[model samples]
Target chain A: MAKGGKTLGEEALQQVARRFAVLGEPMRLRILQSLMDGELPVNSLVEATGGTQTNVSRHLQTLAAAGLVARRREGAQVFYSVADPSIFELCELVCGGIRKSLAAQAGSLR
Target chain B: MAKGGKTLGEEALQQVARRFAVLGEPMRLRILQSLMDGELPVNSLVEATGGTQTNVSRHLQTLAAAGLVARRREGAQVFYSVADPSIFELCELVCGGIRKSLAAQAGSLR
Candidate 1:
């Protein structure tokens, strides 16, 4: 935090905030999640995410731009999957964190 | 993905999407970034995150509810930090993914 005897202050937080903003969209998250199940075609993604083909494609583009998802073209079809395995780790960690909070809350309630 | 030999369909992605939705807020991201810097007191968090005291307080509660953050009280002040170190891993992985994407883009451009 200290910089030139003071602080870099807010911009540091803002940079990280932008990353979160990129991931904040529901459609994008669904696209990432679908990728986790396995590499999926864009049409498959649309059906799996319950989003329109146009919306699903748009979200996939957003996700690809963010580096959360990647696509591979084989012949005429492109399959998309989580760009890095670490994303699964993020999902698991967040899921586990949620479980832990629920347990703590139940304990407090009791 | 399988329900009765086919698929659980879309609900699976929706659950994960909601979780991502909770984490996608910028102020929330800033709060988490501050926690990553280290556990911080509420007043310090307000300063570090550049958010109103009331807003910081509200965001912390939302984070607590999401299980992405936890608070410990020492004396009269509450300190908040990432509930799971895994969140840091998420940040790092996502950041790394971004770097990789940039590198790929550069390579392609070249």
Candidate 2:
């Protein structure tokens, strides 16, 4: 994507930063990773992440607030799925860069 | 990119979170946005960001440490550029999500 046409205003920058902060927690990322398969309920997420239900729920709340995941209710159970597919694209881009940096560092060490 | 094949280990999760944290700061994002066009020296970044040289330099150091931006020294001047083209992709993805969320919120208010 072309990214340099205009400078971001302070408010816009903060909104962007807020999105990054939402994705900055390891536990949150774990929860997000689990949801990538499809919609999953809280219990399944807890099992998938091996995290306490309370902890997983807390992260889910944050992720929902950030619009990274969408939640649905069926009977007494709640299911969550990725709110936007672009999230995975973002993850892939960052992870690809990280892999490249690691490869370069290893090359330098040799 | 697919993101759910295997759960990331703790170390890998931290590495990913660290990348998010690096991008979580508004000032650093501003600095990065400035460099999307081409490499620039510290002084130009200071002007583009309306930030002091010391402040801009400090954020640049943090960005470099995180592998988000790269530095090159020529003669007496140091220039900085986005280390990976994927950085812009990440930004675009997050920004697009934020815009969508905002639009949804606005729609609800109507």
Candidate 3:
């Protein structure tokens, strides 16, 4: 928990960094977007992301390791879904910021 | 602009990943935190982050490239500030998600 007027300790900062690193790959973001609506099997993720099954699985493993997504085993197929909804908020914040920055740059050009 | 019921295109996803990669470093996060209140010169950022001036300046460059922060020249001194306030929101979202994940893991252990 953040204390009032207190700086974040080193450990907390590192944890935040790790989370950002997990989201730093474009393919991973695409996979996450595919899973936004509901859990999806590996093949579905591959189709949605237009990535190979190996590549999608690798990214899914990383996302799961970071606790961004949850994996469930049902018979032979494994489905992945977002374990944390906050990811959408993070993406929206970043995307919105990019839009604002672009608009500012355009304004300055005029 | 995101269309209704449309998925993000590759270019947009790449831009988002670039933004996340810029923020994936703890040192960069620390610099951003220091500048949260207001703009600060390079030396001030170095002191606040306990990082070398060169390293801090390098990270600042990356951040500025990503449009997350902006730099201004004040005579011989250069100051940096969060150009996009959305950064704080993104950090808060990721940090909150991490906290929730940790709590869930702890609960499962009990």
**Top candidate, metric TM-score:** 3
Worst 10 residues of 2 chain B by lDDT: B1-10
For this target, which candidate reaches the highest DockQ against the unseen true structure?
3
Chain B TM-score, all predictions listed: 0.74, 0.88, 0.93
How many clashing residue pairs, candidate 1? Answer: 0
Q: Write the per-residue lDDT of candidate 1 for residues A4-106, one digit (tens) a residue.
A: 4222235543544455556656677667766766899998988977899888888788777766677899888889988666666656655555556667778
Off by over 4 Å in 2: A1-6, B1-7, B106-110
> What's the ranking of the predictions by DockQ, best on top?
3, 2, 1
lDDT, residue B5, candidate 3: 30
Better of 2 and 3 by lDDT: 3
Q: List the candidates' TM-scores in order.
A: 0.72, 0.85, 0.95
By lDDT, who's the top model here? 3
Compared with the true structure, what per-residue lDDT tens digits does model 2 show for residues A1-110?
34353667778889889899889988889989888789999999999999999999999999988888888999999999998777777777777899888876688689
Candidate 1 global CA lDDT score: 0.69
Q: Summarize candidate 3's per-residue lDDT along A58-87 as a digit string, tens digits.
A: 999999989999989999999999999989
Candidate 3 DockQ category? high
Model 3 interface DockQ: 0.86
